[model samples]
Target: MQKKIVKMFDEIAPSYDIVNRIVSFGSDKLWRKIAIKKSLKHLPKNPKILDVACGSGDMIEEWKKYTDNIIGLDPSQKMLEVARKRFPEIKFYQGLAQNLPFDDKSFDVISISFGIRNVVEIQKAIEEFARVLKKEGILLILEFTKPEKKSTIRNCIDFYSNKILPKIGGIISGNKEAYEYLPNSIQKFYTLNELCEKLNKKFEVIEAKNFKLSPASMIIAKKI
Candidate 1:
């Protein structure tokens, strides 16, 4: 299953960014920006950053705004290829979140955007995040979560994600299976409180907020 997910991402890596912008209606950028800003409040100047599951290095780009000491890691070789080409000065690693190739207390901040849900062993990945981060290091997660409550806007988002996003994402990326998996993964993912509870085991939750009219949310935590 992990191999298949990596293969799917490799096939769609070239078009992933374009499809994301279209499918998210450009809100994905805002989500990352907001999360990064929140994380920065707890970080020191020029803090080292590790962007796990970075995906063409979009989140890395955001981190670059605050610091140049940044590394990107992803399981998909093709995705890392794109990221390396885009930011040749920065290092990119092809690795899984469950087992990061880094020393303990190696980074001041670690972030995973829209990629944690794809991990086959979520707890193991979270443990790895804690392991690599220094004491009081920031961990930023911007992801899609199942809605905690039913509402009119939630209904609209559900309809768009189920009925519209995959079709458009598939058309643009030319990999419909990958796009179809997006909504399904979100439905199976933890809610905001649930994910924070898991993070609380190794870190103190600083802030968590769901975007208005969107299922996307962010959690910022500090290593305990």
Candidate 2:
């Protein structure tokens, strides 16, 4: 399943960012900015940052505003190819979050946006994030969340995610199954508290803030 999903992303690499910006109505960029600011709190004067599962380097580009010593890692080579072409100066590697190809305590900050839930072994990925991070390093994760209000707006979001996102994403990306997997994965992902608990096993949870009325949240955890 993981391999299939990676290949699907490889096929959609060309239009993935375009579809993402359109589907999220440009709020994805704001989410990345907030996540970066939260992660920057623990960073050193000149921090070394790693972005895992970094689709086409959108988040990495956002991180560049704070620091230049950054590496972007993704499992899909095609996605990396696009990212490499777009940001020729930034380092990018073909890698996975579950098994990061880095030495222990190698980075000061690690960030991943909307990608952790796609990993096959979520625990292993979390462990990998902890392993590569330096002592007191910050690990930031921006992910989709289930709404707490359960109001009409929540119902509307559910309807759009389950019904409309896939249709529009498919038409734009020309990959129906890939777009379908997006909503399915988001629906099957863990909630904010659950994710915080999982991170607490390895790091200290500094903050967890929900955005867009709880449809998205960013969790910042510091390695102890």
Candidate 3:
């Protein structure tokens, strides 16, 4: 199943970025900008940052605006190929999050955006993040959350997310299952508190926030 996930991403690599922009109505771009600014407050100068599951490397590029000491890791070679083309000078490793290729205490900051949900062994990945990070190093996560059930607006967001998004994304990406899997994944994913609770096992939560009318979640934590 994990290898299938990687294959799906590889098949969609050409349209990944643009389909995201279209499907999210361009909100994803704005969300990343906000996430970067918010996460920056806790980062140190020249922090060795690693973006795990760094699809197409856009997030790494955004981080570069702050510091050049950044590298990206993704399981899909085609995705990494696009990323490498985008930032030729930056190093990218093809690897899994549960088994990172870095040494202990090697980085000051680590990030994974919208990609952690697909990880096969999420807890192991989080532990690896902790092991590779310097003591008190920052771990930033931006992921899709399952929405609450009580509001009319939230219901509408759910409809768009589960119904409309897959249709449009599938058409654009030429891979229906890939986009369909997204909504299903989001639905099955942890809630804000649930994920934060898991994260707290490895690190101290610094802050947690949500994007309006969407399941977008961000957590900034530090190694304990």
Best by TM-score: 1
Answer with 2 or 3, whichever has the higher lDDT: 3
State residue 21's C-alpha deviation in candidate 3, in Å. Answer: 0.8
Q: Which tens-of-lDDT digit does each residue in 110-194 have in candidate 3?
A: 9999999999789999999999999899998999987655588878888988789889988988888898899889888888778
What would the TM-scores of all predictions be?
0.98, 0.96, 0.97
Best-matching candidate per lDDT: 1
Instruction: Give per-candidate clash totals.
Output: 0, 0, 0
Over 4 Å off, model 1: none
- lDDT string for model 1 (71-117, tens) is 89999999999999899999888899999999999999999999998
Could you tell me the C-alpha RMSD of candidate 2 in Å?
1.3
Rank by TM-score, highest first: 1, 3, 2
Worst 10 residues of 1 by lDDT: 170-179
Instruction: Rank all candidate structures by their lDDT, best first, as comma-separated numbers.
Output: 1, 3, 2
Every candidate's CA RMSD: 0.8, 1.3, 1.0
C-alpha lDDT of residue 76 in model 2: 93
Better of 1 and 3 by lDDT: 1
Deviation in angstroms for 120 in model 3? 1.7
In angstroms, how far off is 211's CA in candidate 3? 0.8
> Model 2: how far is 18 from its true place, Å?
0.7
